[model samples]
Target: MVTAVTDHTDHADHPGDDEGREGSGHARVEDDFVTDRKDVRKKDFDMKDFIKRDTGKKDAGKKDAGKVGVRSESRMFGLVRVEIDDYPEKPASGDDTDGTDGIGNKGRADGAAGADAADAADSGVSWDDGLIARRVSATAEGQARPVKEAVVDSRPPVVTPLAYDGSLRSRLDALRELVGLSRTRLDSRTLAEAGQVLDEATARRRLSGQHTVVAIAGATGSGKSQLFNALAGVAISETGVRRPTTAAPIACSWSDGAASLIDRLGIPGRLRRRPLQSAEAEAQLRGLVLVDLPDHDSAAVQHREQVDRILALVDAVIWVVDPEKYADAVLHERYLRPMAGHAEVTFVVLNQIDRLPGEAADQVLDDLRRLLDEDGIALGEYGEPGATVLSLSALTGDGVPELREVLGHFVAERGAAVRRISADVDAAAARLWPVYANRRQAGLTEEARDEFADRLADAVGATAAGEAAERAWRRNANRACGTPWLRLWRWYQDRREPPTGRLSVRTHADEEATARQRVEQAVRTVAEQAAGGLPTPWAQAVREAAVRGSQGLCEALDELAVRAGAPVGRPPRPGWWPVAVLAQAAMTILQAIGGLWLLGQVVGFMSPNLGVPVLLMVIGIVGGPGVDWACRLAARGPARRYGLEAERRLREAASGCGRARVLDPLASELLRYREVREQYLRVTGVGV
Candidate 1:
C-alpha cells in the first residue's frame, strides 16, 4: 500500500531528530509525503504488489501516518514498529492487506512510500526516487525495460554583409576637388579666374551636399541674363537693348559658400556674388550657385571662349532659348549634339513662353520637350514632364517661383552634375578609343605592292632595255672576237641584219605611254586605298593634295633629267652594258678583218708558215668570250646606280602619297576626335 504525504518543511523540522532515530539501525530515505486531512481513519496507499480485501465498516480510528509523521524502527523483537506523531489510534481498514497482518502492513507502508514518490514527481522534484523504487521492484519481479532514442535539430541560418560607395553629394565633392587641381594648371588669367569660380562653385556644392552650380548658356538675344536675374530673385545682371548683354559670367549665392564657388568659377570681381537678403530667401536657396555666362552665338571671340570655359566647369547647365530661335540649327548642331552625353546635367529652358498665346504655350512646350528628347535628354523630376518650358517674363516674374522651386528640388537630388559628367566622359572615351588606338593594316597588301612595282618597271621600259642590251651583246661579240676576214664577213652580216618588222616607232611610243600609265595607276590605287574610310571633306582634301604631289613629282623628275642634260625622248632602251657590248663587237670585227687581209698578203712570201689569220681567229674567239665577261662585270655598277635612283624616286612618291592621302586625313580626324573628347571630359569631370 502507498500513501501520499505533504510535508511543510519549516513546520516539520525537529532538532536532533536524526540522532534520536539512529540507534534503531533504521536508514532514512529522503522523500516527500502527501496526505488528506479528511482521510484520518484509512490510508490510500500505492504499491507494486498488494491485494485489497474490502471491509464493511469505516475505520475512523485509523490515521494516515504521512499526514502527521511516521517513524520506523527495527527492534530485537524481530519486528519493524512504525510510530506516528499526533496519531489518532484506530483500527486498520480490512482492505489494507491480506489475512497475514504484518505482510499486509509492510505492503501498505511500501505502497504509501510509492504514493509519496508519485506526489514528489507530480510536484516536479524527484523522478529518481520513483525510478529507483521501480528498478528495485522490477529486479525483484525479473522484468525487462526498453531503450529510448536521442533527438537533434538539422537546419541552419544564413547571413549577409552590407557595404556601399559614396553618396551623390560626396561624389560631387570629389569632382570639385578634381576641377580645383585642373584649374591650377591654367596659364591664361581669364581662364584661371574662370577656374577659380568653378572651384568656388564646387566647394559650395560639397559643403551643402547640393548640386549648387547652375549656368545660363545660350545664343545672343536668348534672354540668358534675364533668366539669371529671375533665378537670382533680383535683376543683378544687366538686361538689354544691347545685342549681347552678359559679356562675362555673373554669379549669385545664398550664403558665404557662394563667394568660394564664384571665385572657383574664375570670373573677376566685376561680376556680382551677392548673398540672399532674407532668411526666407536663404532658406529657399539653401545651396544655390547661379551663374550668368556670355552668349554662345556671340560674334566676339572672347565671348564664345568665356561661354566655353564656364560650361566646362559648371555643375548643371540651363540652356536658355528664345521662342524665335529655339530650333536654330547652329544651337542644336554646334552645342547640343556635341554635348549629347551631358543630357542628364542639361536643362533646356524655352524662355519667353509668356510671349506665346496661352494655347500656343502648351504646344511650344510640347515641341521643345520633343526636340530635347530627340537630343536624348529626359525631362521631369525638375518639375512637370514638359515643365522645362517655363512661361515666365523675367520682366513680369510670372512662373519664376516655379523655376526656382524646380532648381531647388534639382539641387536637393544632388545627382544632375555627377551623372552628367560621368556619362559625358564615358561616351567621349568610347568614341575616342578607336581613333587614338593603333589602326590595323587594311590598305595595302604585299601582293599589291609587288604588282605595283611590276607595273612601274613595265612603265619605265625595263623589259625593252633588257631586250636591247641582249641585241647589243651579240653585235659586240662579233666585233670583239672575229678575225679580220670574220670582221669583214660580220660587217656584211650586220648590213644584212633583219629590221624590227612589228616594233614600229608608234609601237615604241605606245609602250612608253602604257608604262607611264601603269606606274601612275598603281601609285594612285595605293593612295586611294590608304585614304579609305576617312571623313568626306578630309578625304577629298587628301585626294586633291595627293594629285598635286604626283604632279609635282612628275615635274621634279623632268627637272632632274633636264639638269642632267639627258635626252628627253625616254630613258635609253639599250643601257650601259648594251653600249659596252656594241663597242667591243665593232673592235673585234675590225681586228679580224685586218688580220685576214694581212694574212692573205703575206701567205706566199712567209718563210715560217705561221697561220696568222688562224692565230687571229683564235684570238678573236677568245677575245669574244673575254669581252662578253668584261661587259657582264661592267654592267653591275650602272645597274645598281640606276636601281638606287629608281628606289629613291619610288620612296619619295610613296612618302608624298602617304602624307597627302593617309597621314593628313588621319591627323585631322584624330585631332577633331581629341577636341571633342577633351570637351566631353571637361564637362563630365574626367581626368586627362
Candidate 2:
C-alpha cells in the first residue's frame, strides 16, 4: 500500500506493509484533505457572488459571513453548527479586507492565517468539539492534504473449522475400534467383507470427504444403467436393449475429488468419467458418485461378481426394479433380507412407474415397501431418513428431480459412508459376541488357580523333593552335632552306603513318563473346569488356549525334576557339639589311664591304686555314656525342625519351577483372552 504512496502524493506511507495491511483486516490512517479542499474552493468561488448580491448592505454581508461561518463550523465540528469569525476578528478599524473588497491586504493575509487554523481545528473535532469558525477565511488557505487511513489496532478472532460432521467422526471412531479386535477370537476370515468396508470408508473419505458412492444394483432388464444415466443427467454408461451392457463398472461423479475413490473401487479409467461441474438445479447432488454396476442376475458369472464387488464397497445401494421383476426372490431374499442393519443406506427404486396408471403406481410402491418391510428394511419417510422407496421411469426422466434431491440430501449430510461402515461393524461384532461375553464379564475362579498350582506341584515330583530335603537335613544335623563316640560309627555307616544319598534318589524312565502324563492331564482338567459353563465354541477356544499354553511344559518339568531331586545343603548345628566332644575326649583319656593303673596293680607289678584308679575309671566311663545320651536327645528336636524347614523350602522351590514352566503360560492365555474381551466391550461402548 505504501508503494502506491510513492506514486501518488496523497497516498503517504502507513505503519504496516502492503501485504500485511491487505490481510490484517485492520483500519488504516487516512487524511480527509478532499473534504477540506472542496469546502475552501467553494468559499473562494462564491466570494465575488456574495459581495455583488449584497452591495452596500454591509449588515447583509456581515449576516452572510456569519452564516458561512456557521455552515463551515458544522462541517468542521461535526453536526453541531456554531457562529463566529474564523479570521482573526476583522480589524475594528474597517481595514480587515483589501479596498477592492471589504478589508485591506493585511486583513486578507490575516484571513488566510485564520483559515489554516480552522482546518487544523476541524481535523481534531472527532476527538473534541470546535468552539467557533468562518467559511470565507477557509478558502484563502489551499488545503494541500493527505488521505487519512483509518487506524485499526485489534487482531482477528480465532476460529474453529466445522468441515467434518461430529456424528460421522464418532461413528467412524467406533467402527475403527471394532476392527481392532483379536483375529483368532473373532474369525477374521468371516469378517473380511466388513473389514473391506471399514478400509473403503476411511480411504474414500481421505481422498474425497464429499462424494457419496451410490451403486445401481438390480437384475437384468431392470433398466438400472438407464436410471444411473438419468440421475447423472448424462449418457455416461452404455445403456441399450442388450443385457448386462455395463461390462465393468460405469462410474460418474457430480463434482471433483473422487478420483482416488473410483480407483479404490477398481473402476477402469476408460469406464470412469471425470466429474461434471455442479448445476444449479442439481447442486445438492454435487458430491454424489453414482456407480452403474453389472446386473446382479446376469448370465455371465463375472458380471454378477463385478456387481457383488462394487455393491460391497459403495456407500448406498439403489435397487432398480421393473414392475414385473419387483418381487424377484433372488434379489430380495439373498441380499435385502440379509442386510437388515444397513437399512439406513438402502434404496429400492420401482423403475418404469410411468408405464403404470396413478393408482397402479401407488399400489406397486405400497406393495414394494411392504415386501421391503418383510425383508426387515426400515423404509424412510418424507421427514425421517432410512431405507427409501422411490418410484420413477428412467427412460422418460420422470421423477428424476426427486431422486436427485434425495441423493443431494444424503451427500450434503456426508454420513452415508460412516453409517454404512458402522452397520457393518455392528453386524460383525454381533457375530463375535458370544465367544467373549461371559469371559469378559468374569475371570477364572481362585479355586481354579490354586487347583492348577497343586496339579503342577504333583507333576514335578514335589513330594520326592520334600522328602529328600527332610532326610538330607536329618543326615547333616546328626553328623555335625551327635556325640564324638558315635562319630566313628556314623563315619563307618557313611563309608558303607553314603547315608542313603538324601534327595538324590534313583528313578526309572517310565516314572518320568508317567509324571509328564499326569501334568498334561492336570492341564486338561483345569481348562475343562474353567470352561465349564461356556458355549461350545468359546469352551473350545479356552481349551485350545490352554493346550497352546502348556506346550514344552513336559520338557521343562523334566529339568525341574532333576533340580528338585538333587540334595539340599546341610543345616547349621549348635556350638555345644565341640565342647561335648572335648569333654568326652578328656573323660576317655582319664578312663584309659585309670584302667591301666588298675590293671598294673591287679598284676602285682605297681602300688595298689584301688581308690583313685577305680574311681576315675568309673566316673569317666559313666559320664561319657551319659553325655552321649544327652547329645543324642538334644539332636532329635533340632534335626526334626531343620528337616521340616528344608522340606517346606524345597517343596516351594519345586512348585515355583513347575509353575513357570507350565501354569504361567496357561494362566497368561486366559488373561489375554479376558483383556481382549474387555477391549472389545469398550469398543462396543458397553464398558469404560
Q: Highest TM-score, which number? A: 2
* Candidate lDDT values, in order: 0.50, 0.61
Clash number for each model: 47, 15
Per-candidate TM-scores read 0.38, 0.57
Predicted model with the maximum lDDT: 2
The residue-by-residue lDDT of candidate 1 on 357-431, one tens digit each, is 868877877787777668765565454432244556665677778778877777766655555445543453444
Segments of candidate 2 deviating more than 4 angstroms: 1-195, 223-226, 229-280, 352-367, 382-385, 392-402, 427-449, 471-510, 523-570, 575-637, 663-688
Cα deviation at 546, candidate 1, in Å, is 5.5
Model 1 lDDT, full chain set? 0.50
**Tens-digit lDDT track of model 2 for 1-688:** 2211111110011111222223333333433221232454455444335323334454544564322211221122111111121222121233333312111001222344334343333333221111111111111344333333333222332221223355545544655555564565556675575467567656655655566788999888898877876775544566767765767777776654466677778875435553322245346776677888888888989988888788787888989999999999998888898887898998889998878975999998899988988987887786665698888899888887888787778789887876776677666667656665673344467787677767776767666665655566556545554445677886787689853543444445666778778878888987787677654555677788778767887776667556645444445667776876677777787789889989999899898869999889888888777766676777767666655564455456546754664456556656666666666565465664
**Candidate 2 displacement at residue 191 in angstroms:** 6.6
